[model samples]
Target: MTQFSFFSVIVPTYQRNDLLAKCLDCLIPEIQTLPAEQYEVIVTDDGFQITAQEMIREFYPWVKWVAGSRKGPAANRNNGAKYARGEWLVFTDDDCLPDPQWLEAYAEAIVAEPACLVFEGRTYVDRPRRSLAETSPVNESGGYLWSCNFAVKKQLFESLTGFDERFPYAAMEDVDFRLRLVKSGYKFSFVKTASVCHPWRAKGGWNKIKQHREATFIYLSIHAEELVNINSVYYLLFALRSFVNQTVPAILQFNFTGINEAFLEHFAYLYMSVLLWRYSLTSMKSLKNQ
Candidate 1:
């Protein structure tokens, strides 16, 4: 064998022991076909909760556990990757449940396309999207390389320094990674059979819009020349498009219950605009100083 393990499945968690338990329950059965050395499961925790560690020690002792950096999920994941001993590094969030054929499909795809360095897996919520307020990271057709279900060559991931530790938030790090991989000229393949189930969350998404904007700005700050649009006009266009697509639909519902989400959308956009302005001024000032 070329590696101690062909695949190292790394999951990042933050105080969600129950969800992690469910995630592992599904994944454990999927790897029973292969011997212990052929595959490894790693769960890295970023929280102070030792229940997860105790649970893993008592029940799933075969799985490897690591302490997170507590800096953020990006760093937590990279720390998990530090302990990986496989040819391929597979990533999935603690809330996800891999399908029975998930690893099998990836193995087959890797064998079929030996030259491919990265693979995007299919993610779906089995339930209907209840409301515009609900959110899930669903990548049905697969151009979206969501971090919850993807694989990369260990060497390439290390070369890119894994996810940018600068992105201390849970947002846009995956997009930044995908952009970097594209810039490096590696072809990406989507493995439709390598599916993972992401439960649709009733939590509203408008709250995350500002964080997304900040993350996007950070990404632009890092790759200004590589990115196409990095101006005030681009931020305006993004806000306009987002309002039309997201908030407009919530407002069109004509229900008082939807008003809160609509209001949050407006507030998030306002917050993002301010952040964009602040980031632009800082960047320009730094450039002048340089």
Candidate 2:
């Protein structure tokens, strides 16, 4: 067996203990394939109500559990990276279950391209059968990166300082971080054979709107100029079309009953747009000051 270097798997979890349990179960056996002392697993609890300490003790005695500063996922990940003891940091969400050959694939890729700073992997939904979308090709520009299945050199992570904690929600922080990495001349390779199952269900209804809103804010923060570009007009049109498709019928049916309720529920998108504009102006001001 070819020897592999040390690796640290960091999982930043919020309130998904059940999924986390399964993720850890999948991780242990994969890590065992490497030198026993060359791997460590760290789980950072992002202020989830349940005591992760006890859960770790009971189910994952070999893993390290750290109390995350009551910050969002980005901050929790940064905290996890701080405590990692390996030369490479592999990030996977609490809800992700890795394939049996996941770690081995990463090790092989690292050996093939030692200068690569980032390793991107494929994700499939946890289901009985794979769909066309599950098997689609992925590249860096296609929004193919997910924290659920990515690996980075430890020194590279430290140099970049991990994910930006400024994003308070589960949103576009990942995009912003990857953009920075790309700008810094870092090379990333997609390891299609290394895969994981993202078990979280798709968000819909008001929850999805809120997610979009949060994401829009982060998007605006990083791409303020692009928002005003010609392409943005097309995006806004698409968003408006979607809103009308979702809301006009309800309005015509005198669903005034659900109007206020719906507004309260889905208004986060509008709020997020407003905040994005505000953040953009703030960023501009800071740039001017500098």
Candidate with maximal lDDT: 1
Task: List, residue by residue over 1-290, the lDDT tens digit for candidate 1.
Answer: 32223899999999988899988987784454444456789999898845378889988988999899999889999999999999899999999989878887788888888889899999999786545566689898988788999999999999999999999888989988988889889768999999999997655465467567677878887897633455555656766887788666755564444456655665666666666677777877988999
Pull out the clashing pairs in model 1.
Answer: none
**Candidate achieving the largest TM-score:** 1
Q: What is the C-alpha RMSD of each candidate to the true structure, in Å?
A: 3.3, 6.4
TM-score for each prediction? 0.85, 0.75
Q: What's model 2's lDDT at 160?
A: 90
For model 1, the superposed segments whose C-alpha errors exceed 4 Å read 1-5, 30-37, 49-51, 204-207, 230-259, 270-290
Poorly placed runs, candidate 2 (over 4 Å): 30-32, 128-143, 200-204, 223-231, 234-290
Residue 56 shift from truth in candidate 2, angstroms: 0.9
Clashing pairs in 2: none
What is the lDDT for 138 in model 1?
88
User: How displaced is residue 107 in candidate 2, in Å?
Assistant: 0.7
